[model samples]
Each structure stands twice: as C-alpha cells, then as structure tokens.
Target chain A: MDYVLELQDVSKTYGHGRTAVKANDRVNLQIQPGEIVLIMGPSGSGKTTLLSMAGLLLSTSSGIICVLGEQIDHASASHRAHMRLKTLGFVFQSYNLMESLTAIENVELVMNMAGVRGSRAKERARELLAMLGLGERLDHKPADLSGGEKQRVAIARALANDPPLILADEPTGNLDSKTGQEVMELLCCGLGRDQGRSIVIVTHDHRLRSIADRVLWLEDGQLSETDGNYLPEMT
Target chain B: MFKLAWRNLLHERARLIISVGGVALAVMLILLMAGIFAGSEEHAVAYIKRQPADLWLMQDGVENLHMSSSLLPPQVVEDVRGIAGVYQAVGLLYSTGAVDLGETEVYSYIFAVEKGAPFGGPWDLMEGAGSPGIDEVILDSDLAARYGLGLGDTVDLLGKQLRIAGLSEGTFGIATSITFVNKQTLAGLMGVPPDAASYVLIRPESDADRVQVADRLKEAIPEANLMTREAFVASDQEMIRQMGADVIRAMNSVAYVVGLLVIALTVYTATVERAREYGVLKAIGADTALLMRVVAAQAFISSGFGFLVGIPLAYGIGALITTLLPEMLIVIEPDNLLGQVPVLLAITAAASLLPLGRIIRLDPMTVFKG
Candidate 1:
C-alpha cells in the first residue's frame, strides 16, 4: 500500500476568466512501489501537463501531490527541487543530454548536483553507462551518439541518484519502432522489474502496453484505469 | 560547475577563439595606450629625474621645466649653498636651439652645466667623455644614431661649431632632444651674464629635514619657487597627463566598451543557443546559484586567457613601434600591466550579466515541451 507517487484531484489552468484554458482537469492517480504504469492518450489530451504536475515541475491550480510520502503540492521551488533531487528522476522525449558533456559527464552531472563528485561519482557514472550498454561511448559527446544511445544516456542519468520514482515522458518517442521497443523493454524489464523501481511513462505509443502492469487512458484532462483488452482508436 | 563551464566554452572552438581574441585585442589596446602615456611622462621628466638635486629653485610662478621659463639670479645658488643644511648647489642654463645638419635642422633643448658638476648633465655615456668641456657637447645616443654623428664629430649649434664629447642613452623626448654644453660657453653664446642662470639645483645634507630646509629656502629667497625632488617629478608628470587626458580617456572608454560588447554578445549567444540545456538542468534540480557559477566560470576563463595573451602582444607591439619610430617612447611598467586586471575582470563580469538574466528567467517547463 506504500505508493512511490500520488496525485489527488489535480487541476491546472492557464490564464483566467473566460480566456482560461484547462490543461488538466481534476486528475487523480497513484503508483505503487515497483509498478510500471503507462498513460496513453491522443495529442492535446493533457498527458504532458499531468506528468509535469506529478514531477513537481509545474504548480497545480488545485490538487495534492505526494512524492515519497511527502506532500509537495505547495512546496517552495527550492524545496521541490530538493525533493526532485532526492526522490524523483525525469526522462524527456528528446533525451535532453547536455550536448557539451560526454556520456559519462552527462550521467555524472546529476550526481554532482547532489554533492557527489570526484572518483566515486565518475566510477558510478561509468558503471551505469556500461550497464546501459554505452560503455564504449562513455567519452563521446551527444552529437556523436545515435538517438537510441542518447536516450540510453538519459536513462542512465535519470538513475544516477537512484531515486525511488522515474517519470518518463515519451522516452521512446524519437526512436524507430525497433529501437523504441528495445528502449521500452529496457525501461520496463531492465529497470522496473529487475531493479524494483516504480516508473510512470506518458506516451502515445500503445505498442508499449505489453510492458505495463496497469494501463490508463487520458482523455480531455481526465485519467481512468482499464483492462489490457481495451484499445482506443487511433486518430 | 567549473567543469561544465569549461566544457561549454570548449564545445565551440571557433566562438572561444573569437571571444578570447576580441578580449585580447582590447587588452592590448588599453595597455599600449597606458604604456605610451607612461613612456611620454617618463621621457618628459628624464632629465629632471637624473639630476642629483634634492630641491629645485626656480623663478616664482614657474611650474615645470618643459613649459616654463625660469631665469633666477645667479646669486641664489650661493645663497642656497650658504644655508646650514645645504650640501651642494649648482646653477644651470636651459635654452632651445637648432642644430643645422646641412640638409635638415634638428631642434633640441640645450642644457648647460658647469664642467664636473654633481648634477644636471648626462649620466649614461655610450661613448667618449662623460662631461662636455668648453665648446664641447653631449648628444642623446638616439639623436646621434639618427643623424649618423659620433664622438669627436662637430655639429653647428646656434651658428657655433661644438665637438660631440659624449653619447648618452634614452635622453630624447618626443618634441625635444637634449644636448648638454658648458654653462659659461652657453652664456657667452646667448649674450647673458655668466653669473645669471635658468635654475639652481640644491642637495640637502643627509641628516637634514627636507621640508624644513625647503621652508628655510622659501623664507630666505621669496622671489623664487622651491620644490622637493618628489614634488617636482609629480608636477611634471601631472602636467603631461593633463595634456593628453582627454584623448586617453576617450580611447580607454572605447576599448572597454568594445571588450564588454564582445564578451556580452558571445556569452549571450552561447547561452541563448544552450537555453534548452539550461532548462533541462533547472528541471533536474540545479539551483540558480549553480547555474550562475557556470556562467561566472566561463567569463573568468575567457578573461584569464585573454590577459595571458594580451600582455606579450602589447609588448611585442611596443617593440615594433619603437623600432619603426625611434622617437616614440613606449615603456611597459609592471604596475601598468597589473592595474588592468581589475578592469578586465569587471568588464567580463558585467558581460556575463546578459547571459545570467537569460538563464535565471528560464522556465523549466520548456524542456518538457520542446
């Protein structure tokens, strides 16, 4: 019953009055430890907004967000940053690796921010890169790496601090079908199952459903759990 | 943070070179101007500084040697010597005359001193005799080399042939070349009384209080102005600085502005190009201070490299100018180079402000979107 992340009646709106746009409307969700949760929706369905709120990257108009059993909906920016450093990790669709840094450096950047440095941080970063199958490319910058390799480096970076939860927004969105499947397998089987860490992935790629312990459908800013048999029609 | 900043700078090699080169050029310009200014001041007062006098007594209302005409009564020298603290007093005769080189005339300031006097004559002798005798002259080596004159060569000064007795080093000013002759000979040529002189040089006793001696001299001789060695040097340098203060100030301002723009534009562009990366960093929990540190590190590295490159380049340029124009004095002092460090650092820090603002206001949500 211990959840890694929880959201209660979260709603986020932009602007005000008649011109206000609701990005997320009254969304509630929770992910237990060691669970793999998948959120699938059409374009403009507020899937990204919901993920942003859960990651403590954006303030919610009205809601309660808890990460690692600490209420953080009203946390200060600095406090939220600290919690993110201590408990949460992020994987972006674009990989978002610092182009100036090598693979090992990108992975070590987070650890450095968390006060880990020198030989220990370097050793851990190398190990993570090698584990992610990027050992030979450790010194190569992002420009020299392929899309799949970049995403792998991003995943290694997200896991650098060993946070309890990983919030991935379309981790495989930029890769080919085969590479996407491979990355998905790595995230689910390699990370979620083998490492016993909770993962929340927001993606439009329904092919990823087989790896999910629970599938949720988001439509017009609302989320609902469903059995694996249901498939939303592709627009 | 420093590693990140260094990597970011090295990531774009072309930008790094251009930015560093720009700063280097600015530094070179500022240093060159300062060196030339300092050189000019030094040259203007070289003769005054070389004198062994601790005090200079001139006619009242005469401010400096170069711009003023001081004709003191020759009796002032004996009067100053009679003082209790007076160690030695020598009279000098200063005038301007032209040396006819057959094809062209070289204008020079003529300094006439008593033969074998303690001061007011050339100290650095490259060749021949140390002090000029009657009808003999000492010319600056730079002037001698330029006109192909040597020791024992005779030159026409004020229509009188005077043999060159010695060649002194580094005694040439931009507008005036100093030539020394016997005081009695110069007085006869100018038709002034041999007992009258331009100024009197005085050396105080070793144990004497210079201020008290100066006060006593002021009281004993109310018609003349008396100044200590340090006071006279400062007055001469201050006069020279004021002459070019407007131009030097304008050039320094331009150099600083150019340096600021170069650094600001390069850093701002680099930051803008990496804005998304910065957002990603913010999203991953980099605080504002850390990000600022990264920027400050970049500025410092750039400035440090620029300074390292600029100093030698300035000196090289100064050497080149001296070779090309022997009359131009470009003296590089250690203090001049050291004085520019703070200004360069300030410009670099100010330049980083442009990029700092861009990074601080960056929204972390942008990384999630695009």
Candidate 2:
C-alpha cells in the first residue's frame, strides 16, 4: 500500500550526556489511505514522541518525514504549520477544545482561520457537528458538554479541513470506558470511512486496539506488530 | 481570520469586560481634566470678551492688564476719543474686593464700565441683577447659590452697603464672581474718591482697523498702553495657561501612564492565559501577523467599548460637575472631547503591542506536550 504518511530513521533526544534520554531512536512508521493504525505503549515508551514527530509538532533530531510524498523535514516553520493545518488534522489527548467556544463555533474556528468566512463556513461547521451526532449540542460550550460530547466535538474539529491524514495522541485517554469505546469507534471510523484519508491513533487503551485495523506495540522505543486481540481486556 | 479575533474577544468575555472598564476609567480621568482646562480657558477670556471696547488703553509698557499696567489717567479716554476712527471711549477702574453676605465674606472682582457703555455682561442671569447703578451690585449665579443671596438683598462691598440688582450667569472668574457697577459706584466702593478712572476703553468704528486705532491711541496718549481686542484676549488667556498648563500636562501624562499600564497588564494577562489557545491557533496556520492582528483586534474591542461608555460617562460626569461647580470651573466642549478619541486609540494600540509579542512567541508544539 502506498503510504499517506512515512517516517524514516526518525530520532528525538532530550538534554545531553548522562541525563540525556533518547525519546525515539531511528523510529520508522508508515500509514496508508483508508487505514486505522494504533500505537500502544506505556507513558515513556515513545508513542507520543513518535506521534509528535509524525504530526510535525516537533522537529526530529535527525531523519526524514514525508507526508503525501512531500518531504516536510526540511520545510520552513510556517510551511510545516500550514501543512499540518491544511493536510493534517490532530486530535489531542486532552481534546484541547477551546473551552470558551461552543461546539459548532470550535469547529468553525478552524474553518474561519483557514480563510473560510461568513455563513457558508458556519453551515459547514453545523454539518460536521451533525455528522458526529452532536447536532443538538451545536451551541453548547465545552464547559457545558459531557466528556463524550467534547471528544466528538474535538473529532469534528480535527475533521475541519477534510485533511488526508489524522494524527491523534490518546484521543480517548480522558474518557470513561463506555465513552472511550464510543470515542474510539467514532475516531476509527471518523476519517477511514473516506477512501482518501487515514487515521493514526497513539493510545494505550486496549479497547481502542480492537477498533484499529492494525496495532503496533512500542516497547522501549521499538515498534512491532501484535495480534489486535492479545492485549488484556480493559476494565 | 480577523473575524476569529473578534470571536475570541467575545469568547473571552471576562477579559473583555475588565479591559473595557480600565480603558473607560482612564478615559474618564483624561476627559475630566480636559474639561477643567477648557473651563479655565473660557474663564480667562470672559472679561476680555465683555470689555465693551474694541481697543484697550492702559498705561504704556503694559503687556497684560491683570499684572503689568499702571492706572492711566481718565483724561486718556478723551485723547483716545480724539483719535481717528475712534467711535466711543469710557474710562473704568478694574480691581478686586471682598463682599460680605451676612456671616460669609466672598472675594470678588470689580469691573467698572461706564453706565450704558457698549460693553455688556454674561449669557444668563442667576442672582439679583443687571447694569447696576451707584451703590448697586450684581452677583454671579454661583456666588448667589453659594451665599444664598437674592435680588432684594443688600451686601457690603469693600465696606459700602450696596443693594443687589440682578444676577448674571456663566461669568464667574476662577475663584470669584465678578460684579459690574458704574465707575462712580466702583470708585466709591474702592475709596478712590471717585476721581480719574484706572484705564480707558475705546470703541473703534466697525470697519476701522483696530490695530491702527490702537497705535494712534498709543501715539495720541504716550502715557497709556494700547492693545487690540485679540491681543487683550490672548494676554488674559496666557495668564491662566501659564498658571495651569504644567499641572494639566502632568495630569494628562499620569493619565496616559495609567492607561498604558492598565492595557499592558490586561492584554498581557489575556495572552498568558490563552497561551495554549495561541498554540492551537498557530498549529492551525495562523500566521505571526495574523496573531498580532488578533491581539490588536482585542485591544480595539476593548477601546471601542471604552469609547462607547467613556464618552457618555464623561458627559454625564461633566454635567454633574457643571451643576456642582461654578460655570467657570468646568467647560465640556464637544470638540475637545471628540478630539481625544484618536489619542486614546493610540495609547490602547501602543500598550497592546507588548502582549502581541508574547502571543507571537507561542509555538504549536507547546500544546502537544501537554
């Protein structure tokens, strides 16, 4: 399968000498269209580190990252952010919804910042919220919504630009088991339902493992594929 | 994108409210001080405007009537009248005295124009009267309100008892209300033995050159000082300007400092509070200039709200002050108030720049770390 996002020999090191920790060492990954890939690891197993590098949120100490066959490792800061905003959608662990904005407004915020103005952008935001089953919560602010609703709103925001690649770091980490499962299912099917896009969710929740098409286990900065059902059942 | 800036301002409603209040307070202080300065200016020129003559003839070498002139002989009025284009001339004594209203004594200025001279008085009347005769006096509205005097009341002026005739409005000097009386009444009140008046006022023909009339009067009576109407008004205005300009300037500077500090702290707090949101915005392709504009837009929102509330509050407060104060204590000129809008905007923009710097430094990767 042709990879929609590819990372080659990616490495990120923090500090130096004895105190230095290698967050990711020569990490390599590939994500293809219409696929949902899950990266599961403990807190320090470099799952988020690798995800950040793939998402272009952080600069790698060394190596190349290619998105849609375009090398972004050497891209300018503004160019990289533009690529992220236009071609990549991110779902943060905390949901990262602007608490002040209503659900629909949060979605519209991304569209508006991307130069979408007036009533059309607003209508598009409403459509996305309805697609996420948040039609009734459109005008509800983040503070007034439930955990599941907020996560769905975050998913709607990530889908704002209809980007080809979605990068999520523990997207359901803050939800309870039921909401987490619903969020995982929503996220897994959120973009992959479209033929031209893919999702890469970095999470430790075993429940999410069943929803992802393939699971990649990261232990001590190394990735290896595991049977999707081998993880211990979530409580 | 800039529309997002406006939405963000509304989103962060608390910050908007607080910042608007700060700007309004600063605006109020600045406007009030401006009103006082304007009032002082009007007061300084009041008597000059009512001088009854187009030409002022004082002792030679006089630069200001209030400070520099010696008493010119009453005969100087005849000499000035003899000058070509001089229409009418009247000699008058201008001095300061104390008036006794029962247990309270008030200091007042005495302007003694000849009875039935071309010069008249204020815009309105508030107390006992107009065109006072010998042993008669007029009290300013504020003075009447202050001492509880009425039209039929008798007051002691510089020791002589004079019956109150009519009250005038909008003609109060800095600390005193002026009394207008005929030359004989004022001279008698001052114990000048009703002799030659202190200075002469000359009215030139309507189309005549006032400066030329002034020069001819100077030549005709070398012992008297001659000044055009404009010079006379300017000289009087300069005294108040000199007395109060520095203080007003310093107050204005303090107001600006307070405004700057308030806006800076408020915007800076807003920026720091939303550091993560800024990260999200940057991650979403918001450029540096876009972020700067967003910050500036927030400042504009705050200032715009301030403009709406501050101007009317300024007028309301100014009105209250105008009511409580003598007319000369506050002048709320619309033009002066309107002129301050741009200056306030400049302060708000400049103060918000520092917070914009903080916002521009936000990195999209910062939020991912959390």
> Under CAPRI classification, how is model 1 graded?
medium
DockQ of each: 0.68, 0.46
Q: Model 1 — TM-score against the truth?
A: 0.87
* Candidate 2 interface RMSD, angstroms, 1 decimal: 2.0
Candidate 2 per-residue lDDT, tens place, A1-235, comes to 4578999988889989999888888888888887888888777888878887888878999989999989998898878878887888888877788876789989988887777767987898898889888989999988899888988898888888888888888787788999888776766765454545689988877777677778988777777787887853322
- Off-target runs (Cα >4 Å) in candidate 2 are A1-3, A231-235, B1-3, B11-15, B59-63, B96-108, B115-138, B148-167, B181-199, B205-231, B361-370
Q: Each model's C-alpha lDDT?
A: 0.87, 0.77
What is the Å distance of residue A230 in model 2 from its true position?
A: 3.2
Among the numbered candidates, top lDDT falls to 1
- Which ten contiguous residues of candidate 1 chain A have the minimum total lDDT? A226-235
Candidate 1's C-alpha runs over 4 A off are A16-19, B60-63, B78-89, B95-110, B114-119, B123-169, B179-192, B202-231, B242-247
- Clashing pairs for model 1 are none
Residues B79-174, candidate 2: write the lDDT tens digits.
677889888887778877787888887677677766776554444666544577878887786777677888878898888888888788776755
